[model samples]
Target: MAEMTQITPFVNCRDLAAQRRFFEDMLGFTCGFQADNYAFLRRDNVAVRLLEVDFNLDDPARQQMVYIDVDDVDALWAELEPALSKLPEGRARAPFNQPYNQREFHVSDEGACLFLFGQGIEPSA
Candidate 1:
């Protein structure tokens, strides 16, 4: 079988610049490469590519979601809360352990992509 290589999501957003700004300033992705209509960004070991498109707010498309497994959810929240809270709807939902056994919170970036940062829930004492 052919060896499987990297799989990076190519996101389509309304504004490329806004998406770049959000990923850089808000989500901490560094632009590794760029072109007229697209950019490749990376943070740590994760990579994502963004493409500019005429996105419709009313389009019944599957929402884009990114799950970031973090070591300290609380610390990440504290660092980002102040900036996130200022967005029109960028408020980060308080972290809660899910039924699937993960503690996570959701934050929406400028392009309306939902990012869920999570950690494994500790067992009750």
Candidate 2:
């Protein structure tokens, strides 16, 4: 038997620096690695890699939507509320807590589509 380390998501973004700022500002991820066109960030328990590319023009051609689990949904939503409401257009944005789950929301730095899954319906051990 083998133990498994967690696998993290890497999203291709249009601007590396802007994406770094978004992750840092909203998620508290600090720069883990960087040079020119790419960087790594880790905050709380979430690890994400931002790759620079021009796959989007009209809107970000977001290839990845990473969802992370968190302990508090409302608190994070409060932190992100002002910015999330100011999206230009055509970006899927919302903060929702249904009977089955709880979530906050945001866009990737490239305006590439992304969001957070703060809580979920799960069975207790």
Candidate 3:
């Protein structure tokens, strides 16, 4: 049996340039490399390099998803609040009271894919 250690959930995007800008400028992801139809992105400890799906080699049909784990979901979302609000699909998760709870906000990238996620945790005393 093959053991799984790490996995990348890749998604297709329409434009590499546009998605690059959004991932870097908006999402604050660090650029790894860039070619004609492909680019790699990294953010902090998490990484799932992006590929600008090849039309000739593969299909560009839509499939929306990208979930990011963070130390503090609410705080991370707060930091992303302003820019997120501008996103067409951006929807705020209702506020709640709990110790280390789940909070999520959905937003669209430049290519209009429903991407970006935040998972937060409140430390125990």
- Please say which candidate is ahead in TM-score: 2 or 3: 2
What is candidate 1's TM-score against the reference? 0.82
How are the candidates ranked when ordered by lDDT, highest leading? 1, 2, 3
lDDT of each: 0.79, 0.66, 0.64
Q: Residue-wise lDDT of candidate 2 within 14-122, one digit each (tens)?
A: 7787778877765567998998878988877678777787666345344556777767766676766666555457453566655554555545445554655566645
Most accurate candidate by TM-score? 1
What clash pairs does model 1 have? none
Per-residue CA lDDT of model 3 for 1-125, tens digit only, reads: 99975556565676788778887866778878878887778777766556676454223445566766566766666777776666555344433434545455566665535654656545556
Each prediction's TM-score versus the true structure: 0.82, 0.71, 0.68
Per-residue alpha-carbon lDDT of candidate 1 for residues 1-125, written as tens digits (9 for 90 to 100): 89975667877788899889988877778998999999999987778899887757336574577788888888888877776776675356878878787888898765647788999986654
Instruction: Please give the distance, in angstroms, between residue 103's alpha carbon in candidate 2 and its true position after superposition.
Output: 4.5
Q: What 10-residue stretch in candidate 2 is worst by lDDT?
A: 101-110
Q: In angstroms, how far off is 79's CA in candidate 3?
A: 1.4
Number of clashes recorded per candidate: 0, 0, 1
